[model samples]
Target: MRLNSLVKPLLITGFMLAGTAQAAPDAREVLEASPVDDIVAQYPEMMSRGIQDGLKQSGQVPPMVADSIGFLVSNSFRAADIEQRVVANLEAALTPEQLEEVHGWYQTPVAGKIAEAEIAASAPAAWPEIRSRAEDLNKRYQGTAREKLFDRFDAASRATESAVDTTIAVQLGLGTAMAALSRDSVHHEKMRERLESQRPALRGMVGQQVYDGYLFTYRDISNQEMNLYLDFLESEAGRSFTRVVTNSVQQAVIEPVESIGARLAAFGNFGGE
Candidate 1:
């Protein structure tokens, strides 16, 4: 399949929506209003390409074939119905009062600027500057005030774990499909075990990605703008926002991704049968 064909179906498949909407200011409103899609539409595609190249490096697939397949699979995943599914997954997790508070925060000038920065950071063109800024920021973050910033950033974003979790899950899915095509003696359980074992190694890379992402995203943001964000994230309102997002993702994205890997493995099993 081509890139154009795969995007919507991929999202729908990834999330498996049932078209049911709940109350207002729910997960639906939260996801759409958040920088979720901007983040989603870009990163998974990049990861898929990396997975494809990595498979080629391991002699599991030819580079040309891997590129075509990876492109097809990743492009289709530009969040096919994912937002709706995420919205659907929330079940009054955020009280109306909390929702209102979070909504007000999102409307703030600082939030808008930060959102723009985050979305832009996902772009391929942003990598060089992002990396450079992250390096500089890491060096600068040794003192008390700056150490506090990294702590707040980690708490708000959960960037390292989120990145690692997401990468491993999607890589497993793509790896399963690749092993099938290459006729490798693949045991899904064993593959998962190996990947799980590599967590320590993967953490640093994912952490770095998240770190650069933060620096790049907030590169030109003013200290006041930064503090506004830091305050919100550290506040109860921020905690609620993060909780609901984590909950919705667990329901809509994470669980469904596990299903995708299983289904791909099942497909290989059926082929053997």
Candidate 2:
């Protein structure tokens, strides 16, 4: 399946409904407004203001609201959709206790904190690796095939990031709810052990196999766009753009989201009810 085909309807719906007074903001809007605000508020140095049309920062005028909304919608929708598929895959491969253990990893304060810290520590290292890998792969392939591969990787990465972040949020937000369901240290520990025992199977749910599929599909249609981006990155113009996008996304986007997630988790209380 082409990424465009998968994303077009979502983009259209988001664009048509942007800023309309619907009964409840669609998931994308709620995501855009709340999380973006939370992010800005968390980092006063990076972001002097919140989402105004787009994400405003101290030095930079934000991107157009439509563009930011589209990016958020495409990334968010893809992530949520793919994660549901992952959950379905895990449901078939793992037991209930195992699944709850996976959930527990997200629910526990230490685990959640560790995961966030790891991602932050790893991102600087990871991006260069991703770029290098993509470049090498492109060199081995030619023409449309190469383009498709890059696009697929980019889309999958975005989706994966969104999915992971949302999972963290859900886990943290509903820690209280989950505690109400599970009681006693023995029970919780047992569930954790079951999940740990099934680690291979659970990892498969978010592993390279599924991610490769997402990348392959994206590359099929967006090869040209991917090539253009790569070329720019290889040039001065692209270098600047890359720095801005990377920095803004990390400082303005990821940091705030993780902070809010931590706060929500703290508010929920780590213990299961």
Give the number of the best model, judged by TM-score. 1
Which stretch of 10 consecutive residues in model 1 shows the poorest summed lDDT?
Answer: 15-24
Q: Give per-residue CA lDDT, model 2, range 143-170, as digits (tens).
A: 6465445454444234344434433333
Each candidate structure's TM-score, on Cα atoms with residue i matched to residue i, is 0.73, 0.26
The global C-alpha lDDT for each of the candidates, from Candidate 1 onward, is 0.67, 0.38
Question: lDDT tens string, model 1, 31-146?
Answer: 66778767666745655555566668777667886676566556545364555555554435666677767777887778888988888877766666776677777776546354
User: In candidate 1, how many Å is residue 39 off?
Assistant: 3.2
Each candidate's clash count: 4, 7
Pick the lDDT winner: 1
Off by over 4 Å in 1: 1-27, 41-47, 53-60, 75-80, 132-144, 250-273
The worst-scoring run of ten residues by lDDT in candidate 2 lies at: 45-54
